[model samples]
Target: MGSGSFSISGSGSGSGSSLVLDGERGELVRAPAVRIGKKGGGKGGLLDEKAMIALRNHSEAERRRRERINSHLSVLRGMISGTDKLDKAALLAEVINHVKLLKTTATEHAKGYTIPSDTDEVTILCEPQPANTTNTSFLIRASICCDDSPELYPELKQSLQNLHARVVRAEISSLSGRVKIVFFIIPERGEGNGEMGRKILVDSVQHALRLALERVNSSMEFIPRDSLLNKRRRVSHFESSSSSS
Candidate 1:
């Protein structure tokens, strides 16, 4: 049969429902008031193949979309989970590792006698605000500290000549002792209002400083050694001298 029909009727004692099977129209009709016997005639309902396929396709699409969203959410969850417990010590350690890597790479490049490129023409400095104030903005400073080499100094000077146009007001201050280098730092007024912007500024400044320090250290050729043993030896010597005195 192409289509079958069925009837749902009330059963005995004004209670219970019965479904009568009709094999002709393939439709199930409901008869709530009439009572039904155990007689086995009528039609069964038609099943629409097109509707079933469309419903299955919709459900599959929804499932795939849900899975994709869940994958992104899982990545975000992992990032936030670690960030939630981030402390000063953890941040310091991360910075130290990064600095060490930069130092190593810079030293390797210097060993090969690689000259500074256009990207290294200007130096960026990020300094935190004084402890007395309640503001959250960092002082982002940019300058050229290449007075030693005339060729490099000219390029650096030209790059940083328009510092006022790029950032907040800049001032040239002589760093105390040794060299005649001037520091061009940002003023407090240009710092933004939010913590996120402040953090970005601080991190940018730190990365720039790390790059400069790496270059300087590469030039100077600094090597790390165990200081604890020297400290212990000094303590022993001081104690022996004190005892003799």
Candidate 2:
């Protein structure tokens, strides 16, 4: 027999174990210890040439398995509160209990959840808008909320174009499956008293938003400069007649 080193067994706990990885005899030999011994010799009855090789292989495999299991247990101990004193088996049980409790709580909350109606979920309002320092124009604001759709912006632009409205400012936001758009637009220039003009501007915003809601996947409206000017003149004539009445 040649002379070399061997694994020494320590305290029964797994953590205290080092290299002696024998498992067939149901022994909890601890920490690995390097010892000066005959190269072909081993303690714990693993002496037969074939027997020693088999035991050594089996122990090494067992050690790797324990390492993996302990690694998972260590992660669980870190995540869960008060697991410092727990044994491996107890730690696993605690994790199972914790998961079950979380599932139960989530189930209870889902049972009580209420779905909102269309009216409850959305608000659309239109109003007159004050002029800004950079531009002097009759403006109106339209606020709309609807389900998120890729065609929202195109449809909104199409609707405004139908009424000859000029968009001065626009903001879009999305949250909780809904999209809200706030637009400040200048209605087509028209003949009217100040209050009459304001009313018409507000009406134009409302009409544009109504059209946007009604027309989905519609082509964008494109009005030429000359046509837009003529449309404004028509609006002015209509407002002038209404004011004179």
Q: Highest lDDT among the candidates is held by which one?
A: 2
- CA-lDDT, candidates in order: 0.41, 0.54
TM-score of each: 0.22, 0.35
How high is the lDDT of residue 137 in model 2? 42
- In candidate 1 the C-alpha lDDT for residue 217 amounts to 38
**Tens-digit lDDT string for candidate 1 (10-107):** 54663445353423334553322333233452222112334334544554666667678657555544644353355546644655676698899988
Report each candidate's C-alpha RMSD, comma-separated, in the order given: 22.5, 16.9
After aligning candidate 1 to the native by TM-score, how far in Å is the CA of 87 from where it should be?
62
Tens digits of per-residue lDDT, candidate 2, 33-60, equal: 3333346555532333454466566667
Per-residue lDDT for 155 in model 1? Answer: 38
Query: Candidate 1, overall lDDT?
Result: 0.41
- Please count the clashing residue pairs in each candidate, in the order shown: 17, 8
